[model samples]
Target: MKFRKVTETDVAKIVEMIADDELGKTRENYQIPLPTEYLIAFENIQADPNQELIILENENFEIIGTLQLSFIQYLTYRGRIRAQIEAVRIRKDKRGFGIGKKMFEWAINRAIERNAHLLQLTTDKKRQKAIKFYEDLGFKATYEGMKMHF
Candidate 1:
């Protein structure tokens, strides 16, 4: 498999991945939803300098997985750069092949290339497998993040 930045042509595959109803518990609450406006927003975000959206491609150049890492520069940490990782998904049939791990490594490397000092991600507490996977990759659970959804 090869890794590359996302393009407009890969949106359908990404939507498929995002809309999967089953795989892990985190997906259970997500309802696997992604609206068209979200796609437009992602397109705009991808064009910005602070975001990195990457996909893994097979021999036929079909996207098999995707991950997005966004850099956050904060004044609280003395201007240290941070990266928030999101949308990490691999095709259901493509699991156990190390694709997710590779995608994650690519994102971490991208974060370093962009001068990020820390990387963070959030998963549902019920997703034990996913949480273990992230922990195996050296990610720790430290903070409780609250969200206000509209």
Candidate 2:
């Protein structure tokens, strides 16, 4: 497996991977013509120095996973930088192969390399399996996450 920054060409595959899941099927629109919003968001992310949109590929060069990491510099924690992990998705057929664990390990190492003092992520409450997976990977459920959708 190889990890690399996602390119503009990878957006379609990323959208397909996200839409493969139950929740994503409801939330993402992967219809014909595709959505301009996704590309727009991708470009925005690409332009941000603090944001990293990554893709994991197999030996055959097929994209099997993806995630985004954002490094924030804040006054909290003595002004230390914090890394936020988001939009993590592994191909449905690729689960249970210990790939997700490897992905987190890579993310953690990447955070350390960037001098981030803390690494964090928010997962939907409905994803019990994912919650367990994260806990097993040494993430603590220390706070409640709240969001207001527009």
Candidate 3:
């Protein structure tokens, strides 16, 4: 497996994976030709120096997973950098093959490479299994998170 920055062509595949899950099915609009907003977001992400929209490729060079990593320069923690991970998705068929673990390992290493003082991510509270998976990976649920959606 290889991890690399996503290309314009990979957007649809990425969207497909993102929409494969129950929660995602309610949110993403994956299609033969993805909506322009995804492409626009991709372009915006690509333009940001601290943003990494990554895709995981198998031996055949197929897109099997994807995640977004953002290095945030914040004032807390002594002005250190924090790496935030978001939109992680592994293909439906690729689930339970240790791919997610390896993907996260890569993200952690990349964060270390970028000198991030901490790595953070948020998953929906309804995803119990996902919460367990993250806990297994040494993440602590220390804070009670609240969000407001427009």
Candidate 4:
């Protein structure tokens, strides 16, 4: 297994993985959604110096998991930077096999490479296992995340 930046060729596999996750449910609410295009946009964001997204692939070069790392700069913290981790997904069949742990480690390393002070992510309350996984990885349940779906 290896971790790398996404390429255009990885769009199809990336879409498959995303469409099978909770994100797909969000997309379903859209009148017309093109997952392939979304993947392309992710690549674009990663290419930008201000953004980053890392993908996990197996020996066959299939994108089995993904995570987004956004570098944030804050004034209150004296210009300290942090990496906000998001959209961490592992293929349903590939869950419970240490894939999440490995992917998270990569994200942490990526944050360190970029000189980020902290790594953070949020999960829905219903995803109990996911919350536990993050805690096991040393992520604390710091603040409650609230969102208003429009």
The residue pairs in collision within model 1 are: none
lDDT of 3 by residue, 34-134 (tens): 99999999999999999999999999999999999999999988999999999999988889999999999999999999999989999999999999999
Better structure of 2 and 4 per lDDT:
2
lDDT of 1 by residue, 69-108 (tens): 8888899678999999988999888889988888888888
Candidate 2 per-residue C-alpha lDDT over 1-150 given as tens digits, one digit per residue, 9 for 90 to 100:
999999989999999998999899999999656699999999999999999999999999999999999999999899999999999999989999999999999999999999999899999999999999999999999999999999
TM-score of each predicted structure versus truth: 0.87, 0.98, 0.98, 0.85
The TM-score between candidate 1 and the true structure equals: 0.87
| Over 4 Å off, model 2 | none
Kindly give the stretch of ten consecutive residues in candidate 2 with the minimal lDDT sum: 30-39
What tens digits encode model 4's per-residue C-alpha lDDT throughout 22-135?
A: 657667322224445575586678678867767888899777898778898887577888899987889888988999999988889988998888998878788898888889
lDDT on C-alpha atoms for all candidate structures: 0.81, 0.95, 0.95, 0.79
lDDT for position 42 in model 1: 64
Q: Candidate 1 clash total?
A: 0
All predictions: root-mean-square deviation over Cα? 3.4, 0.8, 0.7, 2.8
